[model samples]
Target: MTLLTVRRDGEIAVVTLDNPPVNAISEAVRKGLYEMVGHLDADPEVKAVVLICAGRTFLAGADVSEFGKPPVEPHLPDVVDRIEAAEKPWVAAIHGAALGGGFEIAMGCRFRVAVESAKVGLPEVTLGVIPGASGTVRTPRLAGVEAAVDLVTGGRPMSAGRALKTGLIDAVVSDLESDAVAFARKALGADLPVPASKRPLDQMPEEFWQAALKSASKAGHQAPLRALDSLRFATENGFAEAMAHERETFLDLRGSEEAAALRHVFFAERAAPKPAALKGVEPRPFRTVGVIGGGTMGAGIAGACREAGMEIILIERDAEAVARGLDNMGKIFDGAVKRGKLTQEGRAERMAGVRGSTDYAELAQVDLVIEAVFEEIGVKRAVFAALGRVCRSDAVLATNTSYLDPRAIAEGLPNPERFIGLHFFSPAHIMKLLEIVPTPDTAPDVLATGFALGRALNKVPVRAGICEGFIGNRILKRYRAEAEALVIQGVPIAEIDAAMRDYGFRMGPFEAQDLGGLDIAFLQREGARAAGQEVPETLGDTLVRAGRKGQKTAGGWYDYAEGDRTPQPSAAVTELLAGWTAGSLDLPRTEIAERLVGAMAAEGQAILDEGIAQTPQDIDLVEVHGYGFPRWKGGPMFATGAS
Candidate 1:
């Protein structure tokens, strides 16, 4: 593809990487870069080299397509080394994102300059590996040890402004090419800085390293800690030794189970937003959205749509309810302000775009309307009925019902083709998962519009066929069932939760249920029972019936102190459920995690077999993004090799 090409401007030579779509550092690009080092070093007329990318971003990272393949010649580390050893000093001109191998290559240059809005990072830890191409070794040499620790272990990009403050880049420029060229020209005569490989290393105390290690330890993922260890090793040893350690660590973890799981999730997430089936289909544009219901879910949905620059009409049954809905959305925006995510002015501006009303006529102008009312068939049907009469025939109608039949909800809608189910997780603005469910009658573009909205809202959209709970909750139902079965079989609830936490989940099933209130699911089951379905009783029903609804009631599967959220083993719960238990069996946490994950995967397999989900990856995404499945374990489907 002729990924690398050079052109001369006076005494400065510009090397542009032409690889399209992120310009990932592929083998061909690596070979070209390695050869160019010597070619540029030999050029008598080239006094300085300005390295930049042609498309949207500088080299984003190593080519993910090359992952798990046989190693090619001219490895990234050697190419970076060759760049550092070149006779002519190099200036990395960065824009968009320079991450992982890209950042390492930038480190190899004598100087790095970026546009003000550009970002740079070493994010290999996210994929279950440390950076392989002198990322750990050269980062601390370029920036300090503390900054290196944050860049490598935390696995998030730093803006160019922050990068300059941290000494990761020389300057933040306005016009990338010309400013970078002038930056290189000025640097040719100025006292040139030492190569990143030769820069003095920063040393930190043991306590500092211990704190860094603790901070880097996220759940049970190994990459973060290992990345920190590499940075620490760089501080302790010479550049060459640290480089070798980092490379060895990267190679060792690349074949590990955690890395493979992460890779599975990585590919799954990449393929989710735009599925292959809708390649040629174009979604209808929806700039104005109507959200019915002013409760928690509706407010969150409206806030999320508003954040995506969509005009929102938050409709409720009454004016008071509409006021409450606006307040609820205000609380969401207020929280963002508190977190420094939004300014008060920005929040006000966003809220200004949202118009609250009680009239269905207000929704007439909306391109789409999502109903987030009570999860009753009649209530939802009435909302849709009103929407059917007022909304445009071409308007996309979506239901945010978690468990009800979407097909039944859209029963008498005017245009059944425009009806779809968009099951957004609670705290919609914060949660990333959005299940895009298509009924049998849903048109392709309508389905595409749902996915399009999901993207606009910055969500991970998974296409799900109409089924009870769709993909996520269906698996969650089985997961909770398996946990209950464990409790019945003598596994301690606290012990089960502990095992899951060790396995990388932030909370176990019972603990999460207690936090979310056990009554929610219990009520769902009760609703199903009321519908004349053969719903069986579970341990949770017994708890809810006893008036333990969760944190609000200060009890559920466990007891809570006055205001403390810590779960204490409840004698009341034990006495209440003693009748359900068979005999006590002390099981290790690993076994408990394995059994639970296996159960979820088994349910996922059934879902796939029934064509409820398009692929195993979709199920995995559902669990990882919607439910609290540990990302490093991939999802139940990938973890259990059911994919």
Candidate 2:
């Protein structure tokens, strides 16, 4: 039946929207609302109206499925207009999230009330479009220009408290729907009520708007700049003009290539939580976890577990190592506190959940054990053997290996079925990618537990079969090989990085290595060579041997000044490299970029071909989240049309 119902809450008529999950604004909902608002405006018996959604949240946003479709009977803006122009004043009750068009509908109401935990924003910029339903025009009026710029440009939701202070919401009460009814009754007492659409905001300095527009373009996203344009139009023109401009800009960006790519990733991320095989299987219990070693990777893993509210037993080689690891974990929490991401009290609570010890015996009580020691096969096997000796027989054992084989690490284990690989990218606590790798011998429940752990940690988990480097790194190897080959042939190193950046990556490969240190990739190459594996002979080994270990050392492929991380093409580096000049090897930037991305795409397809990954989405998730392949480009697979 109808998604909207008008019920009498005493003097106030409560219009409840009942769509399961987040009540997205659909065509049927709009048609129903348009007719109901007309009826309510005609009915003299109704004093005021209170609009609230049933279930956990208000309308989250527009129906995404409606995107790119022909316009329906009642557009969101027209529906909002009808609601606002009603004879009786309308009050909106907001809880959970009122985002994008959802927030726009709330803004259309004369007054709004919300629960303390409620959040609202125009987050359409995140999906690569400005608000099409006059959200941009009204936001600056509801809140001042500064607040509007902060909310729209950042595309972050504002808490109810902030919304109240910024004049976006009138009140925050304990009970949402009833408080909204009370708010509606109180609004009816006003001498004159004004709809939000007719409201005007004070003007800001031209520099403010100019700076916002500049930042939007510099940020490399089209929506924010267009959002600024809409706000500017609202400041200069009237409501109707500004709304028209906003809608036109929204439609333009909605059909843009960047928007299409971003939408692909938006849908991909939503569908990546569970793979096809683990759809019906229940994940094994994973409350407490044991993390072996206390180095950077180990401490990051422990920090992630602790942040997830899991009790952690962080084991190291000795008491000193344990202390160091504990210190590292504390530092990570301290950084979080400094960044306002965690309170001091919250950091203390998280730290309290973790215990530092040199004993493997402490792992007996944990539900899972993740070994995050040195990424050597011998070292990883030794750690697992110790875990096998001390851990519970049923506890899931996993390795944080990037390239090594999991089956080799699981060799001679007491319960080979319990062993799996959880290849977390560097800065493990912060990074989102968790490659949930399973050996052929790994049990279903155990593999599901790995995926569960990734979900609990708020990481993107991609199921991968045992292989040389798995999906991400295998593709990365090929990409890097191509990069080095390009540079060696004739492409300038800086030009190569800038080319990739132009393609929408945050940083190029050479730039990322400086921050992560070049030694690791060097070691990986040398290790592969010693093992009789075919390894590309890049300029990295020579650079490392010359004491150019990257950002930590202030130089690698690119030179850096003291305390500054900007990469300046190095003269010394150029002098050392033979045949790196224009005469030696030169190619078009596009050719280089295509070669890099194309190689990555081919390797990714090969991984799928070899049954190393279940689906293209899995490989795309690994590259996008783990490897920093541009999300707006929908990862390399989607970029290559392989997806």
Question: Number of the top candidate by lDDT?
Answer: 1
What TM-score, over all chains together, does every model reach? Answer: 0.99, 0.96
Q: Candidate 2, after superposition: displacement of residue 599 in Å?
A: 2.0
TM-score of 2: 0.96
Model 2 lDDT tens row, 1-643: 6698888977789999988778999998888888988888888789988999999998899898887787787999998888888887788899999998899889888888899999999888778888888788888888887898878877899999999999999999898877788877777777754677777778878888778877777657677887887888888888888888888998889888778777887777777777677788887788899999888999999999888889999998988999999999999999999999999999999999999888889888789999999889899888988888988898999999998988888889998998899998879999999988888888999988987888899998888887888888888888887888787777888888988988878889899888888898889888989999997667877789889999999899899999899999998888767744444556677777888899899999999999998888778888888888877777888888988
> All candidates' lDDT scores?
0.92, 0.86
Worst 10 residues of 1 by lDDT: 211-220
Clashing pairs in 1: none
**Tens-place lDDT digits, model 1, residues 1-643:** 6888899989999999999899999999999999998898898999999999998999999898899997798989998998988899999999999999998999889899999989999888889998999988988887799999998898899999999988999999999999999999998888988898888986799999989878887547999998888889899998889989998999999999999998999999899999999999999989999999989999999999999999999999998999999999999999999999999999999999999999999988789999999989999999999999999999999999899999999998898999999999999989999999899999999999998998899999999888888888988999999999999999888999999988988999999999899989999999999889999999999999999999989999999999799999999999999999987989988999999999999999999999999999999999989888889999998898887
* Residue ranges of candidate 2 with Cα displaced over 4 Å: 579-586
